[model samples]
Target: MNALEKLKILGESAKYDLCNYVSPNLETYASGKIPGVYNSTSPDGHCMPLFKVLMTNKCSNDCKYCMNHSNRKFERYEYEPAELSRVFMDYYNKRYVEGLFLSSGVFKDIDSSMEKQVEVARILRDYGYDGYIHLKILPGTSYDLIKRAMSLADRVSVNIEAATPDGFEELTTTKNFKTDILKRMKWISRLSNDKNMAPSGQTTQFIVGAADESDEDILKRTNWLLDKFKIKRSYFSAFTPLENTPLENYESPHPKRTSRLYQADFLLSYYGFSFDELVFDENGNIETEVDPKYSFAMNNMDLFPVEVNEASYDELIRVPGIGMVSAERIITLRKRGLKIGKLEDLKNLGVAVKRAEPFVKLNKSYQSVLSF
Candidate 1:
């Protein structure tokens, strides 16, 4: 097949490797007029168009849920390092995409496979096409190759498909969780401390609901990853069974499960909440109906009705409906001798008044009655 035809298949294959984090759901690609062009959002919520495509679909590993699993039957293709570099440059010159996100299945051994991906980045950098590039650091990739990839690309990632070793074994038997995944993550973390290597830092992803793991299981790993590796983000891809694969008949998770996981993740990463602060059901899963913050407030009612005028920044943020920015605004206003006298005044500062009413008192006046 020609390059364009190969791009169509490879681009579709690369969709599951998320590069953007959108709320309630993960949307990696925008509605582009052409193939391989995706809209990657930044931390500041700016939309940056990216060329996301895989190097090849050929694999030596057996990931049961993957479309390109080694045992699966389908057409497979790959791009020579220079070939992909040219394709990306063509798109870059046309302004079709502002960045490149390159990933691939293991066409051969791990190091050789990783080498091909690194070569593409090397080619791009040598050609003076430096804007944004995110390269996938395949599991078990050698430390030297990892360093080379990081030196060229702005960001890199390793997919921690399962939270625990047994859960990982359930998904793929060929790879070792501790040796292949966690060790590589540690290498990236250590390498990332250098300012010149992967300046945007590293990220990771988890496949939710595929294995017999709970939301708590995922969050526990997330907490560890954030603290241990200081990863930029942890993306959760809800497992969808593909036809002709081992998981084809397996049931998929409710979309809300992944959505709620993202909400809880934010609380741990952005909001000042530990894993213990989150409210989970008896089964160790987060309640899908209510957000984690609201659930925490409802469960611990005694902490409610905190006086907005007197509450510290931490306490104000813990109140339901008060965000980091809103809490900061409250503190700033109070420091200026401007007390929050009414619910309307809090709303004007971006507080979700309905959610906050039961939890907050404005200038010594309780706004609403608390009820279970």
Candidate 2:
């Protein structure tokens, strides 16, 4: 097959991996825009720039959940390191892409595949290409390779795929629950803590709906990674079963659940909600109807009517509609002796008080039995 045909096949195969869609930053250029926001102009500029390319399609490991496993009977293609680099540079030069997000099947072994993956990034950097590069670290790849990959690429990831050990075992028979995958994440996390390691930190992707793991299990593991490793992001992907994979018959997660998980993750990392606070009941799933923040507010009604002028940061964050930005706004406005009487007052100040009123009280009372 030609390069475009090979890319079509490879990219089609990779669509099952959901992290490919999430944009980390919102400051991306609209198509055909010129002079492109210079990288140095704004630190937050070009956050979601598409890093599009797949290096190879051959594999050796038979991960049951993956479409490109070694034993799968399909036409396979492999791009030499130089060929892959050229395709990436061509796109980069044309300004159609900002960077390269590359991954490959385990062509020979984990280490060899990782080494070749690192070579692509190395070649890019050696030629003075300075845009974002996200590399996927294969499981069982050595620490040396991990370090080398980190040095060359701006960001890296190792897929944890399943939340629990039992779920993990059921999905990929070739993967070891004991050491192979999680260890790689731990190593990357450690390297990220080093001051000089890399500007962008480590990230991981979990395949939702592939197994019977609950939202509670997912959130708990996500929290552990955030607390233990300070990971930059924990991506939750809705499992999309492929043509011949073992999970092809399994149903994909309800998109609502996936979205809720993203919100819950944001609450854990940015908002002050704890794991226990986010889960609805003993079973550990979030309420599908109400969001985690609203659920928390409704469940703990007694905590409502907190004086907007007096509530601490933690308490204010619990209020619905009052995100970190608005919460801080309330704190600052209160200090200035501003009387936050009406919901309109908040609206005028750009605070989303609709969700915040159920949990907080303003200085002046609105006509309602509930607090402002």
TM-scores, in order shown? 0.97, 0.88
Q: Residue-wise lDDT of candidate 2 within 11-63, one digit each (tens)?
A: 55544433333332222333234222212112333244454445677887766
Best by TM-score: 1
CA lDDT of every candidate: 0.90, 0.73
What's the true lDDT of residue 305 in model 2? 67
Report the CA-based lDDT of candidate 2 relative to the real structure: 0.73
